[model samples]
Target: MAKVLMKGNEAIGEAAVLAGCRYYFGYPITPQSELPAYLAKRLPEVDGVFVQAESEVAAINMVYGAGSAGARVMTSSSSPGISLKQEGISYIAGAEVPCLIVNVMRGGPGLGNIAPAQSDYWQSTRGGGHGDYRTIVLAPNSVQEMADMTITGFDLSDRFRNPVLLLSDGVLGQMMEPVNLPEPNDYDINSKKWALGYRGNDKNERNLCSSIFLDNDELEEHNWHLYQKYQVITDLFSKGEYKDFAVEEHLCDDAEIILVGYGIISRILKTVVEKCRKRGIKAGLIRPKVLWPFPTAVFERLAKTASQFLVVEMSCGQMVEDVKLSVDGKKPVFFFGRTGGTVPSDFEILNEVDKLVRPD
Candidate 1:
């Protein structure tokens, strides 16, 4: 493996190719446009397929079709674009197909600016569409993780026959960093017996990909089956009660206040944690690398020690909801955030934490 300097968005694109993704269907949107452009140029050289669909809807459907046919497929979109694709995402989930979705989120309730945001936390982890299904969601704070997680996401999706989300933002998408790209994964996706596209004789049972259950009882039964599948997924793949440290914790061993963040905001807060530690503030930080399976187990343990929690994000306060749920009110959780293209400075974060530590 060789280390090369690359923008985060380009790195994600490259990583997908390295992960054996041969089918890419996407629509162009800002901050992440470089990804599709990179793939458009690169995929051709590698004999991969790249299609610029008329819209996000068409693009996601194309991914569904390719994935159903046993192709390593992927798509990328921004927040608003992602919203439009949710219907197709639900369909993919229902069909039990393996495909990768990259959401380089930007600010938005609707058509929000091209600035980076963590606002899509609920949409990515919870339900982006109407269903009881789940998507394995990974949030990468650095360009290296952006590359590394792409390979992991593909593996996870294939392992469970479900969708996997690479949740990043505009900040990570455009930022540049040196990354050591791995060799194209030698994963044997063919080992998946359920995958479609078989040329075997009539003696072999055919593979079917569908989410449509017209009967009420059948739909309910299908949902329950999916639930059991999710449980098996949880049993085998989910990090256990003591195991959610999949989260990154910094200097929380004896801290009075713990700062919680993810993605770029979390990276920024690490420097803030160091600054606060220098001032003898005893500040800690929690960064969730996997947002869907969240780091609730870590929060339960930290709630007993830390005096308070401060959640910082690039949105008005999306992930904070999960933070509050995880803390379960054991400690007072406070939030400070900026949205719509506005990034908070280190001093701003420092001051916010100072307010939590200081008395009236």
Candidate 2:
């Protein structure tokens, strides 16, 4: 299997095709338009369907319809676009429909900039819209992971009967790298017993997909069921079932200071870790690949050993809150961030680490 040089967004599009995604409904947005563009052209080649819906809200509803019909469906957008789709996302989660959503994050409180940012961390992990539901969020730090996670996301979506989010950013969306794309996955749409279009004649019941459980008690029961499923996912990641893609613990064994980050910032933190080692500072890194079930166990395990934790992000500070929660004040949690499209350099971060280690 030979690797191909491709941009992150394009790689995601191709990976979805390989994952047997035959339906895509999304609106174009900066830093991620390439994904839709690639799919618009490539999906047809594979006899797939691609629709550039009029708006993000409409696009997500379209995804819901297709997913309910047992199709491997997907959608892509940036920060603001994802915001508009939140209500529909919540509905999908509540209805227990399976689909893949890609959010190529950009600077934003209100369409801030086309620059890369991780401001959506809270929204992605905290169930952005109404209701008490969760979407499995996967943060990829590289172009290769971008492709790999897209494939993994679809599989997870189906396995859990829930939506899966590939939380990327502008940097990863636009960057180009060589990716060894996975072989095409063979999926049976009719095998979804819960879906409306099952082919097996043995099925005698009608499958209805709807988030509206009018009765309060019925909704409560549904919510509790969703909670149990989420717990199962959290347990799996904590137990290292998906450790390879859940989190990356680099040089944290005996490190006194640990750095925490995800997405592209993790790549920078890795470099800072190397530089810290050269300076004789025991610095480690915790990169969460699965952001929703956030791999908090790693932070909990390291808090007793590591002196302090420094969380780096592209936003002013979002993920740091999660780190603090994970560490539970057992160790100090510090944060360093640059917003408005400004990416922090390795030198800037190493200096922060120096201050933490050699406080004046």
Candidate 3:
């Protein structure tokens, strides 16, 4: 119908239903509690199922079970709760089950405060659980992207038969904005010939979903098969969704400095880049909508002309390492971060940018 104002968490919850999610299992946690809370009330209106599990561990297994049975399922939690779901997430990944997991990160190492933080960058992009598996991760910087990414997350997860993560921080989770919601998707989930119960009786075509291969050589073979699928997924879901690799940049043709940020942090950097440029400084901002694929092409392209790189995040420099890896010694990379519920303000970001451009 029409665009409407929505909170980020609520937008994601609503987007899941439109994306054809019928099962949602999650426990409540700060910064993201609204996600499950909204789903619990909104899902049934669409004839969907929402369960507030006893714990984060239980919630993820519930998602695993639903996904295995060929249902569009999802789960969400804050930082610590997300950690508790790692085992279940890895299990779902190994079993080749399609599901969605959302992390609205708060400050952490333990029970850190309730404000926004991107400290979970490494936890999300890296293998958080035991195994040689990878999960596709989408980082949304606004309430609208949060909603859009939720729909895309389910599609990618089902297409790859792997878990997809919508990674947001407390700011993006709690803020409000206007969004044009997507039309409800009528998915053909049962079309998967390999789904658990959809396989019509055939001795040769039994659907067996498991990660364990007792024999070493058999396990190696299975791993190789999974790796091949991952490459295909990288080509299909990741690159396909992000045709330009979803890297947003500005004023980079002659930019001497590159300021990289994502999620809510990038929102601030957008203005900083403009203001810096107005003051005769060639500063550009680069942001990634999909963090797992890491969008290295943007860095490689800018390396030819950019002299310095600066990464600003709410976390204590987790994504900076990725920036360095992307640059590959082509340029000097620096980082500015504020943790434990603190956000990098426009002034601070500008000051950091000035440090990189100033003469010694």
Candidate 4:
């Protein structure tokens, strides 16, 4: 009920616990290690399980095991660590198991730096692994959102019977701010009749959770089913079913120049928007709270009025492509990015916006 100063990573750990996540399996990775460290100290107090697995690959598989048994399970990692868990993530998705994956992104292509970056946008939104699967991606822009999205990630995972990713970055993962932690959620594991170990006297049907459909037709049918589910999620968000979980439109009503960003970059863009308005530039922002099932409809609507769109990120232009596709040539889409963990200042972004709006 009260607010307290907390670091983003630790706040996320506490939020996961409150979301009824009784099982946590993860390997330590920078920018996100504090989360598992906090859970190690806190989970035991609540009778939850905290396991530091031998490898990132192992950690994700453990999540698969716990989630298959109808438990609220989660795993976290940084960029390279997440890459290692891709196959396991794919397996979990194929099996349609409910779980949460936290990716506190860092600079990368190799084992980049421990510093923050948004270079993983394509990997996160396009299903990083080798499959026709989709993971629901939720991006948080602040320390408070890091905690809030963690709770929402778990609920959405269970609701859709799929993995939900909280795509944060090193900046938000390491930042400290006051947050109002929510009350613990009440989860009924038995309500998940599709999961294994659901208790219903002696008449419960044996539940099997597996992604291996040896029969070609069976696999094809399964893939189609997953596709339909993804369509439903995209359609719902487009219809404004989930507010605050999809996109945030700031001052975009009559904006001629629309700024786009997500995670921590959006925080910076908010300032740029205000600065542009102060300068009478008619600038606004469309921040995608959820990366996948991207708020394409929003862009389509704004493309009619907005003369151009500028996408700012902590890495070389990634999300800009999606904005381009969404705008679909109705209006020009531009991009400015800083790579290798560099964060762009509001003034730097404003300069980019000036070139587009002024062009003198």
Candidate 5:
């Protein structure tokens, strides 16, 4: 595989096509419009379906329709536009449809700004729409991961019979990076045995795709089944990435404070970790690449030994909530972050850690 310079948005669009996703429906939104535009041109070359939906709501419903028909479907949008699609997203999840959703997040609270920010961490990981549902949200810090994860998300969604979200910020969507493209696989729309498409000779044997369960017991049964599936997913898929530095007897081995962050901010924090080590300050980073099934066990072990935890993010302490839940009051969990497109620098986060480590 050879690396090619590609923007995150373009890479996702191209990767979707290569991943056998033959249908794409989405409306235009800032910082992510390139995705749909790229698909518009490329989808035709592959004889795929590309619909520029009238609205975000319509786009998501189209995805639901395609997904229900057992086609590999996908949709993309930015923050405000994604809000419009949440209703359909919930519907898709309720129907137990496998689909891929890409959220090229921008600064938000309602069209806050068009810069990069990880404010949507809570929305993507937690059920942003309604009901007790979970979307396998994959956060990509680099353009390469953005492309690779878009394909992996579809595979995971189909394997688990659920929706998967590729969460990326505006900076990632717009940035260009080298990516080794994957070889296309042969997929037939009518080949899957589980697909409830228009087939078979007997009418009585036809399968209906729907989320509406009229009977109370039937809906409860469906919900329970979904819960069982989620349990299987969590058991097999929960993972995170950590960058450990060499620590002596009383450093990370018996340290008091641990720094936690993710996404591009986590990359910056890694540099700070090196500087902190040079000055004899003990610090390690727990970067949750998979934010939803949030490596709770990994952090739990860290909490038992660490004296304190500092959460750094680009939101008003959204991910900090998850951090607190994981640590479960075993240690002090402090938050330091900037919201609405204001990102803290490596030094800024280090200063906060220094304050916690050397309290007066």
Candidate 6:
């Protein structure tokens, strides 16, 4: 495979088309609008379907319809647009439809700015839609991962019969980088026996696609089954890459505190860690690539030896909740961040680290 320079959004769209996703339904939203525009041109060449639905709601329902028919389907939107699609997302989950949802998240609350932000971390990981379901959310920091994970999301969704979310921020979606596209998998969409259109004149064959279970016991049974599936997903899918400098002696081995972050902030935190190392402050980073099914055990192991943890993000300490939960009050977990498009600088993180290491 030859490596080509591509923007993150374009890379995702190209990856899906190459991965044999034949149906794409989406409406325009900032920071990720390039994705639909790219697909509009590319899908027709491949004889694929690209429908700009009347609204995000319609787009997701279109996804539901395509997915039920056993076609590889996808949709993309920003935070607010994703919110509109949540209802349909819940329906997709209920129907066990396999599809990919790309959330190139922007600033939040309501009709937030178009700048890049990680405000949708919780929403993506914790089932942005209603009901007791979880979307397998993958957070990618680079343009390459954005493309690669889009393919991975489709595979996982089909394997488990669920929705998989490819969560990226506006920064990653707009950034340009080199990516080596993967070879197309030899898959036959017609081979799937459970697709809605495949139902025929067989006598034992009354299959109904629905999320509405009227009987309470039946609903409970369905919920338990989904829970078991989630457990399997957790065991099989949790993954991440860690950069531990001098981790043998605790990140400090001879110092006091460490900084933890992921996504773009983790890139800046790496610089802070290097600066701290130069000053003999001993710091390292634990960047969780898979935000959902978070690497909680890794943090727990680190908490046993690390003196303190300084978590950095671009939100109002959203991921901090998970950090605290993982640490289980074993040590001090401090949060430092600026929300609503105000990204903290390496210097700012360094100052926070300094303050934690040598308090007032």
Clashing pairs in 1: none
lDDT of 5 by residue, 24-107 (tens): 999998899999999999999999999999999999999998988888899999998888999999999898889999998888
- Per-prediction TM-score to the true structure, in the order listed: 0.95, 0.98, 0.96, 0.98, 0.92, 0.93
- Checking candidate 4 for backbone clashes, the offending pairs are none
Put down candidate 3 lDDT per residue, 200-280, tens digits, no spaces: 656756676777789999989888888898777666533565656467887788889988999998889989999998989
**Candidate 4, run of 10 with poorest lDDT:** 236-245
lDDT over C-alpha atoms for residue 97 of model 1: 92
In model 1, the runs with Cα more than 4 Å from the true position are 187-189, 199-203, 234-245
RMSDs, each prediction? 1.9, 1.0, 1.5, 1.2, 3.7, 3.3
Per-candidate local distance difference test? 0.88, 0.93, 0.88, 0.92, 0.82, 0.84
Which residues of candidate 6, in runs, are more than 4 Å off? Answer: 199-206, 238-256
Which pairs of residues collide in model 2? none
Better structure of 2 and 6 per lDDT: 2
Model 4, 1-360: lDDT tens digits are 799988899999999999888899999989999999999999999899999999999999999999999999999999999999999999999999999999999999899999999999999999999899999999998888988999889888988898999999998999999999999898766678788887763675688899999999999999999999998888877775675559999999999999999999998999999999999999999999999988888999999998899999888889999999999999989999999988999989999999999989
- The residue pairs in collision within model 5 are none
What lDDT would candidate 3 get against the real structure? 0.88
280 Cα displacement, candidate 6 (Å): 1.4
Q: For residues 1-360, what per-residue lDDT tens digits would candidate 2 score against the true structure?
A: 698899999999999999999999999999899999999999999889999999999999999999999999999999999999999999999999999999999999997999999999999999999989999999998899988999999989999999999999999999999999888998878878889866564747678899998899998999999999999988887784686668999999999999999999999999999999999999999999999898888999999899999999998888898899899989999999999998899999999999999998
Q: After superposing candidate 2, which stretches have Cα over 4 Å from the reference?
A: 201-203
Clashes of 4: 0
The lDDT leader among the candidates is 2
